[model samples]
Target chain A: MNCIPIMINGLPGNVARIMATSALRDERFSFVPFSLTGEEITQGEVSVDQTTVTLLKPSEREDKINDILGSYPGFICIDYTHPTAVNDNAKFYVAHKIPFVMGTTGGDRQDLERTVKNGSVPAVIAPNMAKQIVGLQAMLEYGANTFPGLFKGFSLQVTESHQQGKADTSGTAKALVACFNQLGTDFEISNIEKIRDPEIQKENLGVPEEYISGHGWHTYTLKAPDGSALFELKHNINGRQIYVSGTFDAVIFLKSKIDTNDFEQKLFTMIDVLTAGK
Target chain B: MNCIPIMINGLPGNVARIMATSALRDERFSFVPFSLTGEEITQGEVSVDQTTVTLLKPSEREDKINDILGSYPGFICIDYTHPTAVNDNAKFYVAHKIPFVMGTTGGDRQDLERTVKNGSVPAVIAPNMAKQIVGLQAMLEYGANTFPGLFKGFSLQVTESHQQGKADTSGTAKALVACFNQLGTDFEISNIEKIRDPEIQKENLGVPEEYISGHGWHTYTLKAPDGSALFELKHNINGRQIYVSGTFDAVIFLKSKIDTNDFEQKLFTMIDVLTAGK
Candidate 1:
C-alpha cells in the first residue's frame, strides 16, 4: 500500500514532526522531506519522534525544494512549517503546480488562501488534523445550530486539561467555548479552566495534563437553579492519531476536489469547503 | 489523641469493615465487637460483608442488644445496617442514651426520627459519607442556586465507569446530575452512560479499569451551535476512604450536637448536624 507520493516541507518543528512520523505510518501516503532553509530545528540531537531525518535550516529551504524538483515531477507539498512562511510556501507550491496539504496551525490563513487562489494551485489547510475530534467538533457544530434551546437556565463550566508543556489554553478548547457562548449564555473565553498539573489531579479537584496531553479530554457541565435537572457532555481522546487521520482525509478530499479541475481554485479551507458543500 | 469508645451495631458490612480497619490504624478511635449476638457465636457464620459475626434474626435483636448493654455503656453505636430497622435500633439507643452514627442508607426515616426524638438519642446519618465529594456537591449546589440562567442550546451525556460487581447506579452520580438539571438543562437519568467492561474499555478506548474504579468518574459537556465554545465538569474517585473520613467527622460532630437531656425534642438530618458551627 504505497502512499501517494508527497514531500513534507517542514520536518524540524513540533507539529511537523508529528505529521512526518504519522505520514511514515500512513499506507495511503508516502513522502519526501524538504527542510526549510532559514528555520531553526530546535529538536536537538535526537528527536524521539519516528521521523527519520535531520532538519534543513531556513537558508537551505529553497535549494532543498529546488534540489528535489527534478526527482519528483508531480509531488504534493505538505507544508507544516511556521505560519510566517505560509504565503511564500503557498506561492512556491503554485509556481511548481503542486497540490499541497498545509497543517501548520497558526498563520495568516487569509493571505495564504488568496495567494493560492491567484496562483491556481491546489491546497488543503486546517487548524486541527484529528478526524474523530473533528467529528466530535462537527457534531458540536450541528448540535449548537440545531438546539438553540438546549442550554436555557444552565450555568456552564468548561474545562480542558492538557500536557504540562502546553503553554497556552488549547485553541480547540477556546473555540468550543465560543460555540457555547453563542448558544445564548454570556461567557468569556477566560471562563474556561485550563489545568496542567497531575498533582492537583490527585486531589480529585484538578484536571491533569496527562489526561489532556496528546489527546483532548473536554467536558462541559451545565447546572440550573432549583436543582431540578442536569446535562453533561464529555469527549475523551486517547491519542493524536485521531487528528492525523482526519487531516489526511481532509487533504485527500481537498486534492480530489481540486484535481477535478471543475473550478480554478488553488487552495481551500475546510470551513469554506464544508460551508460550500452545505 | 485518645478518642471516645464506640460500639458498631452493624459489625460486618463493607462500610463497617472499612471503618473498623481505619479506626484500628488510627490512635484517635478504638473499636470492639459488641454487635455480634449469642446466636452468632453459636452459628459461627460471618455476614456477607465479612464484618458481621452473625445475622441476628429480627426476633433476637432485643436480647442481643441487652446481652452487651452493660459493658458497652457510654459507647456510641455505628449503625450500618438495613434501613427497615432504623427505628428499632434508634429507639434502643435513645432509651439507653447512646450516641451513635447511622451510616446505613435508606429506611423508614419518619419513624426513625420520631423514635430518636422520643428517646433523646443522638445519631449521625447520611446517604453519602465522602467529604471531598460532598464538597464538590456543595459547590455545585451553590452554583445552581446562585446562577439560575438557562443556556440557549446544550446537550448532556453522563458516563459513569465503575468496577465490576457494582450493581447499582451511583447515588452520587445521580445527585450531581440532578444538580446539573437545576443549573439549567433537561436530561433523563436512565439515559446516562454506564460502562462496566474493562476489556471493552481497553479495546475500544484504550483506557484501563485501574484508571477508574472503587468510585465514580462523571463528565458533562456543553457546546454551542458553531462548535466554538464548550463547558465541562468532571469528578473522579479512587477509593472509599473519602466517604469514611467525612462520615467519621459527621459522627464526632453529631455526638456533640445531641444534648442527652433534650434529644426527645429535636429532629435533624445530616445537613443540620454536619453544618453545625460552620
Candidate 2:
C-alpha cells in the first residue's frame, strides 16, 4: 500500500509534537518534514522521534510551500494551529488546492465551512476530535431528529470543566446544548458553567490531581418542570490521547474521500469520519 | 409480513397498558387477549382500546398457559409485571417454551437471567427500554471496553428522580454506575441518590409539574481528584411513550431472532435491539 504524504502544521506545540510523533511511527503515512508555525515560535526546527522537522513561520510559509509541494505533491495537511489563525490557514490550504484536516477550535466557523465549500479541495474540520464524544453527539443528533420537543417544559443545566489553559466553554458542550434545544429544552449557551479553578475542580468537582493539567469534563442535565424527572449526560476525557486517535482517524477518512474524488460534500466534521463506514 | 402474536403480561399496570395500546395499533404484532396479573389485583379484566383483556392471576397462569398456547402457539410474551414477580415470571415463560421480552425492573436479576439461559426458549430482558437512553449506555460500554480505567482516581456522583410512585432507585442508573466502575471510577451503586420527593424535584431539581406523575430522569457526574476535569452523563425521559416504542422494537427484534432459530444468544438486552440492524 502506498503511504499517504501528510504535513502536520503547528509544530513544536504539545499536540503537534504528539501528532508528529504518532505519524512518524505509523506506517500508513509519511510525515512531511515541514510545519507552518506561528510568528511566536522562534525555533527553526523541532525533532520528533529521530526526524528533524523544519518550522516555517507565517512569513516564510508562502515562499516555502511551493518548494515543499514540488517534492511532496498532493500531501494532506493537519492543522492544530492557534485559533486566531484558523481562517487564514484554511484560505492558504484552499488557495494551494490542498486537502486538509483541521482540529483547531476557533475562528468564524460559518466562513470556515464556506472556505472549503467554495474552494476546490475538501477538508474535515471539528472542534472536538475524540471519537466517543463525537459518537455521543451523533446519538443526541439522532434524538433531536427523531423526537423534537420530546423534552418540552424541561430545564437544562450545562457544566464543563477543563484544564486551566482552556480559556473558553467547551465547543462540544455548546453543540450538545443546541441538540437539547431542538429536543424542546430552552437552554442558553451562555449559562454554561465554566470551571477553571484548580481548587474548585479538585474539591467541588472531583477532578483528579495528576490530570488537572490535561482533561476535558462536561455535563448536561435536564429536569422536568414539576420536580419528578431528571436526565444528565456527561463525557469526561482524562488526557489528549483520545484526540490523537480521532485525529488520525480523520486523516485516514479524508484520504479515502480524496482518493474517491467524493467532493459532493466538501466540508466534514468528526461525526462524518466516525459514521463513514456505517 | 406475518403478524407475530404477543402476550403482554401485567395488564392494568400503567406500562403494560401503554405497551398493549401500542401493540393494538401496530400492524407488526397481534396482541394476545390474556394477561398474567398479580393476585392482589381485584379486576378480572381490563379494556385497552376497546378490547377486553382477561387477567390471569398467578395461580391460574399455569393451567391457562396451555389453553392460550393452543390458540397462539408461538406468541411472544412481554412482561411488565411487578419487580417481585420478575424471577417467577421468567420461570413460567421458560417452562412453557415461550419466548419473552422482560421489561420489569426487579427480583434476583441474576436468577432471572440464569432461568432463561438454562431454559430452551429465548428472551429479551432489560431494566430500561428507552432506545436513546440505551444507546447512550451502549456508548459508555464502548468506552469501558475500549479504555478501561480511563477515569481512574476520579470521583462519581449518581442521582436519579422518577415518579413519586417509583419505590426503588433506577435500574438504569445502577447499570450505568457499573459501566463507570469498569472504567476505573470507584463508585458504589448503594450510594445513588434517589430523589422521590416532589418538592425537591420541582423546587430544586427543576422537574416539571406536568410530568411529576410519570417521568424518569437520571444523572451521573464524575470529577478528577485534583480539581481540573469533570464529566457528567444524563438521560431524562418524560412519560411512558419512549419505552413503548423500544418494547415494540424488541418484540420485532425477538420475533426475527426466533424465526431464524438464533437461539445461540437467548438472553438479549435493549442494546442488542437498538443495534440489531447494524
Candidate 3:
C-alpha cells in the first residue's frame, strides 16, 4: 500500500497532538512535517521538533497558507486549527485542490459545507470522531430520523462538561441539541449548562469537568407524567484515544473516496465515511 | 373497554402491593379480591375493602383453591407468589387454562418455563416488570447486540447499593454483570464491593449515598495501552420507579400476547417488550 503523505494544518492543539501520535502508530501512513504554534504546549511533555513549529498568530493565518504552498505539495492538509480558521484555512485547502481531514468543530457548519462544496476539495469533516461516541450519535440520528418528534411530552436537560479552558457548552452538546430539536425538543443553548467544577451532579445533570477529565459525559433524560417515570441514556468518555482513533479512521475513509482525476464536489462528514456501506 | 377482572395471588408482599396498585390504576384491568396473610396492615394507606382480604395459612391453600375454582372459572391470575409456590401455582393455572402474569423471580427458571409450556397458559414471567426501566434495559440490549464484544480491555467496576434489606447484590446488578460478561469480561460478583450505608459509600469508593437513596450505579472504564486513553460509561439510578414501570410494561405486553388467536409463541423479556418492534 502506498502510504498517503499528509500535512496537518491545525497546530499545537490537544487534538492535533493526539492525531499526530495516532498517525505515527498507523502502518498505512508515514509521518510528514506537521505544524503547531509555540504556546499551546502540554507543559513538561517531551515537546515536538521546534524546527517543525509554524508560529502563526491567529490574524496571520492568511499569509501562513502562502508559506505552506511551497513546503507541502500533493499532501492532504489535516486541519486541526482553531475554529477561527475554519474558513480561511479551508479556502486554502480548496484553492490548492488539497483534500483535508477536518476534526475541528465549533464553526459555521453551513458555510464550511458550502466551502467544501464550492472548493471541490475531498475533505472529511465531523463534529465528533470517536467510533463508539459517533455510534451513539448515529443511533440518536436514527431515532431522530426514523421516529421524528420521539421526545414529545418528554422534558430534556442537556449537560456536557469539558476541561477548564473550554469556555462554554461543548459544540458536541450543541450538536446533540440540534438532533434533539429535530426530535421536537424546544431547547436553546442557554438551557444547556457547562460546568468546570464537580460541585453539581444533581437531580438530572452531567458530572463536572474536574470529575469527568479527558472524559466526555453527556446524558439525555426523558421523564414522564407526574415525574413518575424516567428514561435516561448517558455516555461518558475518559480520554482522547477514541477521538484519535475516529479521526484516523476518517483519514482512511477520505483516502478511499478521493478521485484522482476530478476534484470531489460532495460534502461528507466522518459518520458518512466511517459507515459508508452496510 | 371491558375491564378484565383479575385475581392477584399472594398479595401481602410489598411487590405484590405494587402490582395491586398498578392493577387498580390500569383502565383495562379491575382488581377482584385479594388474599394476604399475617399482619402487614398499613391502616388507611392500603385499603381496598378488608372483607375482600382472604386470609389463609399455607396448609389451607389447597382447600382455598377449591373454593376459588368453584367461584371463578375464567379469571386471570397475577401470581406474585413465593418461590416455594412456583410449581404448584403453575399446575393450578395451567390445568384451569387460566392466563397469568408471573412477576415472582428467584425460583427454578427452567422448571417454571417448562411448567408454563406444559400447562399451555399464556404467562408473562420476569424478574423485573417496570416499563420504562425495561426501556433502559432495551438500550443496553441494543448496545450489546449491535456492538458485540466491543468494549474489550475495559476495567469494569460495578458498585451498586440498594436498600439495607436488599441483601447480597441486586438482581438488576447481576444482570448488568452478565452484560459485561457478554462483552468478554470475566468479573465475578463475589469480588465486587457491595455498599450498604453512607460510610460504605465513602469508604470503599468516594461515592456518597445520602444523595443516592435506593441508588444503583454501574461504571465501566476502558483504558488505552499507555493509560493515556480512557472511556468510561456510568449509569446511576435512584429509586424503584424503574422497577415499577418495567413491571407494568411487562404486564401490558403479556396481556397483548395471549393465546387468543393472535400472536405466535414467542419468549419475551423486558428487552423485547420495551423496544417493542425495534
lDDT of 1 by residue, B1-278 (tens): 34656665554556666676666665766565555222333554454333444445445766766656675555677777665666677776777677777777776877776776665566666676654345446555554443332222446667776666778778877887776676556778897878777765457534444544454555666553334334565555545665566666766665565423434435545554434533
**Highest DockQ, which number?**
2
* Between candidates 2 and 3, the DockQ winner: 2
| Candidate 1 vs 2: which has more DockQ | 2
lDDT leaderboard ranking:
2, 3, 1
Per-residue lDDT tens digits for candidate 2, residues B135-230, read 666656765655565566779898899888889778778888988897788988889999998998899877779878887777787776753345
Q: What is the TM-score of each candidate against the true structure?
A: 0.47, 0.58, 0.67
Q: Alpha-carbon interface RMSD of model 2?
A: 7.0
Query: Which one wins on TM-score?
Result: 3
User: Candidate 2: deviation at residue A250, Å?
Assistant: 1.2
Residue A142 displacement (Å), model 1: 3.3
Error of 3 at B176 (Å): 2.5
Better of 1 and 2 by TM-score: 2
lDDT for B76 in candidate 1 is 70
lDDT by residue for model 3 (B140-229), tens: 555555554545555666666555656777676677667666554567877566767767665654445453445565555544454444
The 10 consecutive residues of candidate 2 chain A with the worst lDDT sum are: A223-232
Top-lDDT structure, candidate number: 2
| Candidate that beats the other on lDDT, 2 or 3, i.e. the better one | 2
Q: Is the docking of candidate 2 incorrect, acceptable, medium or high quality?
A: incorrect
